[model samples]
Target: MKKEFRSGCPISSALDVIGDKWSLLIIRDMLVKHKKTFKEISDSDEKIAPSILSARLKLLESYKLIFKTKVPDNKKENIYLLTEKGIRLTPIIIEFSLWGNSNMREFNEIDDIEGLNSDKTLIIQTVQDNYNSMLLNFQ
Candidate 1:
């Protein structure tokens, strides 16, 4: 799908595509939670509605962030796998999680990434490594 941006600013353009309510959450479900199929992605804590999930998946696909394929055992069902572009967002995702852990903790519980590493650099490296390994399946 063609996108219409309000401005040429880097942050604005990036947000124009992914700044919606459920876009980043969907990406986080795939990246950090390792959700692949429609069912799996829908089974997130945020409980996104089917209609909104469908639209966001299409938008992500149009942007080449993810690819959809039929499940080997179930052709009727599709598995949504992240592309290189999607995997490249791992660092940003981690940053959001850490920032939320720091700032939003007073309001909400967060920081599952702490299970991987308390050190920021170490956690980013670990998640990036995991994302790369996952990309191998697509390649």
Candidate 2:
């Protein structure tokens, strides 16, 4: 499928790829929660439908944000993992988390909000290390 951009604006171009809420949430799951399978991701706090989860996973893969590979011991099962491009999104997610915590009272109640709200660099590095290590397995 062709990736159709709506305009020349950088923000618009970015939204064209990772614009949807579900897309970002999927990235969050992989980066923050280390969720590697469809079931794990679908069972996230948002509870996304299987059909929607399948489509979003494919879209993320097409955009080079994530990839799916067979489990070394179980060929029948596939695991979704972040690419370098996707790992790069960690900072953005951290920033968003911080912003939400600051402005939204409910956001402040999220699991481990205390840790997520402190020391942005630490959060970014921790997620990057987790994802890069996973990527090494595929490489």
Candidate 3:
């Protein structure tokens, strides 16, 4: 039998996969910084444990939010790529980052909120449009 969603709300369903703090941070690292490898992800300041990183990657893959492929030049290493479903999350992540930047004084010192917010709307729209185009290509 197929698994069921927790609810009919789209946001809730999205949260089911990415609501966790670590999961979103991982996605942020991927989308914002383009960090793909396990070592790169684990080395983030968040200090996610190796075991947890492995588990989260598996879970994200299971949810079809990410897919793993052998690195082009390194057969021994795998690179994680976001699926269309995952790419659709770009706006949500950006918004959260913007919100945090606005609310957290310390975060402001580290993040370039003026620059980020200046292009915030455009960035979200571009991501959505590009992701839609990618989905069409997949189809």
Candidate 4:
């Protein structure tokens, strides 16, 4: 579906595009874990179905949250990279992760997220730098 807003409400607008669990999970994999390829995303612990994963990837791309590009020196392979819009979602994802970790035992904190969150500038810079490094490798 194209960028169809249910109303002028910001929350509903966002939910219309990325309210689904699969969408958020895919975003989480790319943003938090830096998963780039379809295979990498499929290998996540949640084990999402292949068909569903494919659809979510396409949807994210359509929403301009991510874009697909050919892997350098590998014409047959493509990788997903987050767009600036996606990068801006970093804080929201971090907060979401922290909230989940607070209640769930299985979802252990994997990174020093508390420290990252405490220092907003450092976290944003870290995410931007990481993306920049990944982009450099493709060039």
Candidate 5:
């Protein structure tokens, strides 16, 4: 589906796809937290409403950020996995984490910045590698 955008600018076009309040968090849940199913995602710490979560999942799928499929053992249960496009958001997620860690510390107690000083490329690569490795057995 051709997505309607508010403007032709690259940032605006990108936001047109993932600017919603819930979309990035959903991607973070899948990409970082490794959430796979509707139930698993819904049961996350964010406590996203079922209706909103359903809509966000469909929107992400329509944008080609994630694909839904069922594992062989449970054809009735659907699991969502990131596409290459979605995996590309890893750096953004990492950046957001660092930004939050440095700027939003008053709101959150997670001050573990041990890896923040590490080579950023290495951090992003590690996440991508782990995600790809996990998908090796995904049918």
Candidate 6:
């Protein structure tokens, strides 16, 4: 059977792929923190299980949000990096972060709201300035 979207709205289409709580967070980690390895993603504060992390990575790859590339020096592990389509989500993630920070004050103490706000803008601009810049730069 073929999968279907709930509606024709662009937002709906996007939500179909990334509406889940974990998927967006996975993308954020890859796009912002440059975390490529399964260990890195699994070890996040969310403490996503290895099995779930694997599934999310596969789903993201299927949607073309991310791509797997062989490590230049190490053939053992493949690095996951965001595609242009995925990088486009930086702003959305930033907005989500901002909203969460504002509404969920009891969650955690944000060191600098101003800095986070500024970083959000900067991150969005950086992604826009160079799409390829979103790719993993380190091992």
Model number with the top lDDT: 5
TM-score on alpha carbons, each prediction = 0.88, 0.89, 0.79, 0.82, 0.91, 0.82
Q: lDDT score, residue 17, model 5? A: 84
lDDT of 6 by residue, 70-110 (tens): 77788898888888788888889878878887877787775
Candidate 6, lDDT over the whole model: 0.78
TM-score winner: 5
Q: Which stretches of candidate 3 lie over 4 Å from their true place?
A: 1-5, 106-110, 125-139
Worst 10 residues of 5 by lDDT: 108-117
> How much lDDT does each candidate structure score?
0.82, 0.85, 0.78, 0.81, 0.86, 0.78
Name the runs in model 1 displaced over 4 angstroms. Answer: none
Which 10 consecutive residues of model 3 have the lowest summed lDDT? 130-139
Q: Runs in model 5 with CA error above 4 Å?
A: 1-3, 111-114
Q: Candidate 4's residue-wise lDDT over 11-99, tens digit each?
A: 99888878988888888888767899999999998899999999888888998999999988888999998988888877777667666
Residue 138 C-alpha lDDT in model 5: 92
For candidate 1, write residues 1-139 as lDDT tens digits. 7589899899998897788868899988888777889999998888999999999999999999888998777789889988878878777887887777678878876645545447777777777688778756754
Per-residue lDDT, model 1, residue 119, is: 75
Cα displacement (Å) at residue 121, model 2: 1.6
| Candidate 6 residue pairs that clash | none
How many times do residue backbones clash in model 3? 0
Superposition TM-score, candidate 5 onto the true structure: 0.91
TM-score of candidate 4 on Cα atoms, chains taken together = 0.82
Tens-place lDDT digits, model 5, residues 1-139: 5567899899999899888768888988888778899998999877999999998899899989999999768898999999999999999888988788778878778758557768889989988898888777795
Local lDDT at 97 for model 4? 64
